[model samples]
Target: MSLKPNIVLVAALALSVAGCGKKEVDTLPPAPGPAPIQSQNQGSQTRIVPGSQADFSNRMAGLDTIYFDTDQFDIDDEDAVALRRQAEWLRQYPAKRARIEGYTDERGTREYNLALGERRATAARNYLVSLGIAENRLTVISYGKERPAVLDSTEAAWARNRRAVTLTID
Candidate 1:
């Protein structure tokens, strides 16, 4: 065979091999489609912002804020119902932790309110623990009368202020 023709054949063979490799790379199966939405969200899907206060509030709805009787740190039957609902929600998100913030009305002294608030928070934490929630996932803090839900000095406002608000934390 002529040297010139042999060289040309070799070059053509090399180019064909390169082209085959490119085709193989391009022919990979199409990337999998996005994962299917969970069956529970059959209609409209609502996106949840995990560990956000807004997310917690949205998921928890009316149960996030549990009101207490004046000068009381114990959880009442009504409060227990709300706490149960909250515990259910918390159980849904195992990765999430909760901060139980206790507050009191403006009637008590600051120090007394602080102590009462701590007791209230602890009370809520204990209730949640009793409801099968892990003790480690819950924390307690007392804001005393400092952070009032309602600013007015009415019975309604005080009633609203004396509460243990459960908030989701990262």
Candidate 2:
């Protein structure tokens, strides 16, 4: 048996074995029936349609927004108080993980803004860690000036844009 013939035989055998194992994947079950839409009167609080509201409320409840002064990453006394409240919330829910997303206004260069945002997130994470939260349970990401909380260029909007947001994950 020459090497070339042997290689061809092996390849054929492998392909045959693979073909034997081929299976028809079941197509996804028919899409669920359309949900019944409910109508709400003008004066009433709109009731969320059941399953849709779960994710909305969960995301809403876990989101925490903290603002920062221009060109600053240090947690000032006022920010410290707010972070303490965030720490307390974490202490209340030991099993949850939180992500600190840092953002900045559009005043600086892209590279500088990214570094600033990262420092801002790290500053917040450090404070949480100092408050006895496990560093592993906290993650940080810097969006820089890319994802502004407010799009306007006014002072008020710029103030809103300089922020770190904490989002809880279970």
Candidate 3:
């Protein structure tokens, strides 16, 4: 009958309704199954089965690796073409991140090769960043002469080894 009682009723209704916005989660269903067991080694990686997206992407667009001249870290016109495609791919899949890995031929000292590898990787990363890719989504690493694409010391082998590879993150 009084306005004060109506106001109190409205306030009580509001208090009741305020908490209804967030529906409580149902009791979770039973586990699908026990988690798969792993070997004792238990590497740092969480996934035992790696993503095949990189392979699929590589098959679709050959933008995985860019070759470099001996003792050079500059991205050539040919490599630029691939890099542009890479930038496009990254743009399309904003969720996908990448790691630019630099590798050098086994010609220089370890220290020298490491420095060269770093420069090579950084060059690739910078080029991708210039193409409007978020810098935070990309990382650079140097493998030096440790992980060669080709093992032999021949000119052709060295040529294949001197390169930067873009590995996609899951």
Clash counts per candidate, in order, are 0, 0, 0
Q: In angstroms, give how far residue 61 of model 3 lies from its true place.
A: 3.9
Tell me the whole-model lDDT of each prediction, alpha carbons only.
Answer: 0.87, 0.80, 0.83
- Over 50-87, each residue of candidate 2 has an lDDT whose tens digit, in order, gives 22323323434533667889999988887787778778
Most accurate candidate by TM-score: 1
Looking at model 3, which ten-residue stretch has the lowest summed lDDT? 47-56
What would the per-residue lDDT of candidate 3 be over residues 25-104, giving only the tens digit for each residue? 88978767535432232574333222345343544365678888988999889888888888877887787788889999
**How far is 21's C-alpha from truth in model 2 (Å)?**
66
Considering TM-score, which of the candidate structures 1 and 3 is the better prediction for this target? 1
**Candidate 1: tens digits of C-alpha lDDT, residues 38-89:** 2234366645455566666876778898888889888888899989988888
| Candidate 1 clash pair list | none
Q: Residue 142 deviation, candidate 2, in Å?
A: 0.3
Q: What is the lDDT of residue 87 in candidate 3?
A: 86
Q: What's the residue-level lDDT of 53 in candidate 2?
A: 24
Model 3 / residue 155 / CA error / Å: 0.3
For model 1, what is the error of residue 103's alpha carbon versus the real structure, in angstroms, after optimal superposition? 0.2
RMSD of 1: 13.9
Candidate 1's C-alpha runs over 4 A off are: 1-46, 50-52
